[model samples]
Target chain A: MKFSDFFRKKSSGDVAKDRLKMVLVADRSACSPEIMERIKNDIIDVLSKYVEIDREGLDIKITQMDGEGEGSDGRTVPALYANIPIRNILERN
Target chain B: MGEVIVITSGKGGVGKTTTTANIGTGLAKLGKKVVLVDTDIGLRNLDVVLGLENRIVYNLVDVIEGNCKTKQALIKDKRYDTLYLLPAAQTRDKTSVNPDQMKQLADELREDFDYIIMDCPAGIEQGFKNAIAGADRALVVTTPEVSAVRDADRIIGLLEANEMKDTKLIVNRLRQDMVKRGDMMSAEDVVEILAVGLIGVVPDDENIVVATNNGEPLAGDASLAGQAYMNICRRVCGEDVPFLDLDVKKGFFARLFGK
Candidate 1:
């Protein structure tokens, strides 16, 4: 059973709306899911440029942005934003 | 003994200096002796904001260096007999002062004034640490924008780490029309994310520009934003004033667009 079904099945539209709000909130603050998508896409693109991409193995995580020493000076994003793992996409000569 | 309060915003240009100057003036106008400190270091401007630049002689650095007495370094505001300013050094960066110096200075300033308002520089760098070093309380200024809100959330976390027991939020530059159209973050939305007590809500007004150019401030009185400031000051003093109108007339498009 999907997680949505655990609490009385939610409509697809409801889930999407919730996702949009969460996404926008995160995006405006520069830590939303869309950002991870962008990074993952870029990484996949670069990897494809070298060898065939491994979509399933491509691990991407979303986290909050950290403003450690910056203080609150810019857009309202979380401090200590997130930690993302990057891979080497060197085209073997 | 006076309470030391630092008006800070994680983001610059969100009105931390303006809030400090105006709140300092407001408290003074309330018959309380207040002193304003500019902690922006090399980018000093609280003096200019308060129209006390020309009167500065012995600045904060001079006093910190023991070149002059703290009393001598403090500029007496011409507009108010009780108000004063300890202007920051325009030539020096944030490295010139540290937390110890700020705590000692606040301890000294407490002897006479009813309030000491420090205008913090932008960012969570050395300047920020120094500004809040002696603060008994803090007022975080923020615009309704996402960036400012995000910065505020982060600052709140830092303040907690620094052990600042008292914290309040002041949302500046709010446009009620936009909120009416759901195009802007409602004050509720901001408060929801920051999760700090709401102190004041200042409207985006041209009067703020007029006040700045005229060496005046929105005191949360005469003007919409001014009146908001006044309420914040009152709330700081432990008053339970209701929220300001922040009232809006839905634009025609807002009306036509929905309920």
Candidate 2:
């Protein structure tokens, strides 16, 4: 977190390997970190038009769906699922 | 039947062709009939690396198109009697052969050879697909660099997706001094990240450049890279060879304690 930490004598191989692990995780989830952030913002914007939702408590994640009865090929399908907790429903009274 | 093994890396310049050439030659040196196949097509370099570029009268395309028999297309190695090369078509592109054709060719070659080492092209394209189509196992070659390791991971994922469950990792171009100085990833570090079985770790040696330039792989010599490749060939043949100790300058205490 310090300035010197950014310029530490860490090998380029370690840095790149860590970055690659992050990238592969994002790729396997079928989304990028930046894209995930955008999706969260866009969803909050859309939901703000209808109700008073707890935006801070909203969570969005992409996970692999277990293909139990999908012909037994043992391949999991990626699915995007989100949970947006609502505190109150706003009325135009 | 001959075991078809593809030497591939999703990234270029990671020594896929070199590894294929060396491993093929090493297997032949062990008296196993081995044929090295270059699947790079237009950018074929395996023959040049093996020093058989001048003897390439027929290529993979020629055999696939029924223009030449498989035996006729195979160029015998000058050093190893059992070693051969199926050079890729320089003028033709990757579209000249498909996965089915490659599989058929591999099946035909399986009857006579003990091992078929396919030098796969870089990138996860049609050529990579075709190279692994007929292979029962894959040796994913990478360097001690991050880009190479990342690409190897992607290639492994692709191979597993295609039902090629038997995959091993070969960490090439490893610099022991750099690893000792904590400036480069060690072979264990790479294997941990890739999460694959380690087949061999070839030290960075200048002799490889000279040998490749001379159209002769170093596997027949006593170079560091050659020994590593020879061990890889033995492992491929189901021999449990211990890894070479790259840290020759280890402290006396370290060796005494088996560190």
Candidate 3:
């Protein structure tokens, strides 16, 4: 949204790791970045209808489950786990 | 038993065959008996890359189907006595040889060779399964590109799932000038994204094209890419070889100023 965000000098090191992790998580769950963003916006819209919430503080991420193990079929089944955090919910007057 | 290492890249044109050929030759040059196996089956290229295509009397399917002995099917390399190749069958598809047969073949070869390097076909299909089935370790080759890195990540997951824990990363076709200009991903960036141990980083060298066209892998050549492959061989041999400094501009100013 900000011009600084557009011109931000991407760190050559960590940027790659972050992108890789994000892509890997999205790939395993069969979700794309655009889909994930849309889902986040939809969730926020639905939540705002029921209760007041801090949209800026909200977070959503897809991650791989801990522990390396294969499925019963002996195929490595990467567990796609999602986490959503809402800072606070306000009561409707 | 010799180590069976599969050179794989989930995406095509990522230099799996080139890496296999060079590493296989590099190991043999180090006095280890190494056999390069072309497991692509229908679309084979290891023989051509190693310049042993014309010498192929029998293919891998011939040896697996008991039509001929494995040794009888292996084509000896003219450059090294310890180096050999088991060319893939061009007529048949990936379904012709299953993972079990591939495992059995690798097991038998383990008794005779110090390193059995399998040149895996691209994609996460039957060909991939067959190649990794017998591998004690995996060396995933990927370029420093978004698509290639993404595929490499998927491959790492698949390898982990298959219980192939000893996987290493080889970032190939890297352009040092691009990395310096922040136009391309660096080797460090790829390794960070893939979350694997770094084996070697091969710079994009024109000599690679020249060598491939000549049906000879630039393993021990004086070229930068060839030196990278040689370093990979050393690492595979359990030697702690330092990574090549691919930064092009680091010494340019000093050279110009004579500092």
Which prediction has the highest TM-score against the true structure? 2
- Model 1 Cα lDDT, one tens digit per residue, B1-259: 9999998888989988888888887787777899999988899988888887788788888889899989998888867788899999988889999999999999999999889899989999999999999999999999887668767867887899899999999999989877754467778777766768888888898887887887766574577778888877788888899987877566899889956
lDDT for B147 (candidate 3)? 84
| Ranking of candidates on TM-score, top first | 2, 3, 1
Residues B1-259 of candidate 3: C-alpha lDDT, one tens digit per residue = 8999999999999999999999998998899999999999999999999988889889999998999999999999978999999999999999999999999999999999999999999999999999999999999999988888999888998999999969999999999877865668788777755668999999999999999999888898888998999999999999999998875544767879852
Q: Candidate 3 DockQ score?
A: 0.30
Q: List ranges where model 1 is wrong by over 4 Å.
A: A1-93, B248-259
After aligning candidate 3 to the native by TM-score, how far in Å is the CA of B196 from where it should be? 0.8
Deviation (Å) of B165 in candidate 1? 0.7
The best candidate in terms of DockQ: 2
For B203-249, candidate 2 gives per-residue lDDT tens digits of 99899999988988988577788899999989999999999987546
Q: Which stretches of model 2 miss by more than 4 angstroms?
A: A1-11, A32-52, A56-93, B248-259
lDDT of 3 by residue, A26-71 (tens): 7778767788788888887888777666666666766654445554
**Which segments of candidate 3 are over 4 A away from where they belong?**
A1-21, A29-93, B248-259
Q: What is the TM-score of each candidate against the true structure?
A: 0.74, 0.82, 0.79
